[model samples]
Target chain A: MLEARVYVIMKPGVLDPQGKAVKSALDSLGFEGLKDVRVGKYFAIKLDDISKEKAMERLKGMCEKLLANPVIEDYKIEILDIKS
Target chain B: MLEARVYVIMKPGVLDPQGKAVKSALDSLGFEGLKDVRVGKYFAIKLDDISKEKAMERLKGMCEKLLANPVIEDYKIEILDIKS
Candidate 1:
């Protein structure tokens, strides 16, 4: 099995209202000195007996096709571990 | 400045239809052999000069109060950097 994480976030120029809300909420609560808060989606995936190469290829494909919207979001993938 | 990440995922017993949908989507798309998939929230936070000690304390508060649901989710925090 292979363990992976994918972090999906809005692209640099995108307007992030969810982030802004969190920041403002924090401000009200006096959690001060926060420069920014950008919220994103994290996916933890376990793949069954797939070769690393195939896993890599398939993972990227998943991100591009469904996991992230290429038009406005960016995604980073990390392979955490592979165990049989 | 400090850069941090909070990964929030549902606990083991929570029903995660979002995860199941993604897995089934992968199956339809011919990305076979996925053992399990869990989707979560990833927050990228930037703090302005709050001492790491204070930041740590506030971060935990954020998670408990708004960032995560104590009844269903578990969160992990990582301190990526503290830039001077």
Candidate 2:
């Protein structure tokens, strides 16, 4: 068994409206001195009996094909654990 | 300056339709041997001149109030860095 974690985040130059909204909401709620807030997606996946290198390759494929929008978003993949 | 990361995840028994959809998509795309998938929200926040303990407390309050739905989700906060 293998577990991997993926984080899909917006590129630095991209404008994140959702993140902006959250920042506004936080300001309204009195949590002051907030410099910035960026929101992203995280995924935890479980796969059956795969080697780490193989799983990383597959996970990147998954991200490129479906999980992330390559134009504006970038993703990071980490193999969390492998349990036999 | 303080930087923090928050992961807001669904409770263990909670239904995650988005994750299920992703799993099905991955399967169709030929990434097989999939067991499970879980999707969550990740937040990277920057704040001005706050101690780690105070920031953690405030971050928790933010999670409870806005970042997560307390009934169905749980949140973990990590202070990534503090720069004076």
Candidate 3:
């Protein structure tokens, strides 16, 4: 089995209201000097018995197909761990 | 400067409706063999000239203060990079 972790974030120029909301909350809670709190998405996937290379290829296809919005978001994937 | 990345996810027993929505969408898009899609939150914070230790202290405080709901969510933080 392999573990894949994916992170998806808004494009640099895009507005992130969710992040803004969290930042404001942090400010209210006395967290000073924190700025640009962009919020993103994280996904963990456990794949069945597949070679690492094949898994990566299929996972990237998954990201492009549904995990992220290519127009307004960018994503990164990390292979966290693999165990047989 | 330091780059801090924090990820927050629902507790194991907690319901993740957002994740379910995404999984259903993936199914509709013909993604087979995908199950248990749990969604989480990611945060990136760029900090000013502060020692790494101090930055970590402050960032953890930020996470507990407002970045995550301790009641239903668990968070992990990564110090991505630090530069002077």
Tens digits of per-residue lDDT for model 2 on B15-79?
99999999999999999888999999999899888778888899999999999999999899989
Identify the runs in model 3 with alpha carbons over 4 angstroms from their true place.
Answer: none
Tens digits of per-residue lDDT, candidate 2, A1-84, equal 888899998999899999999999999999988999999999989998877889888998999999999899989998875546
lDDT of 3 by residue, A1-84 (tens): 667888999999899998888888877887777756889999977666667788788778888998999889999988766545
Per-candidate TM equals 0.94, 0.96, 0.88
Q: By the lDDT metric, which is better: model 1 or model 2?
A: 2
Q: What is each candidate's DockQ, to 2 decimals?
A: 0.89, 0.91, 0.66
Clashing pairs in 1: none
What is the TM-score (0 to 1) of candidate 1?
A: 0.94
Error of 3 at B32 (Å): 2.5
Q: Give me the candidate number with maximum TM-score.
A: 2
Can you give the lDDT of residue B28 in candidate 2?
93
Per-residue lDDT for B1-84 in model 1, tens only? 889899999999999999999889988888878888999999999987766788888899999988999899999998877547
**Candidate 3 has what TM-score?**
0.88
Provide the DockQ value for model 3.
0.66
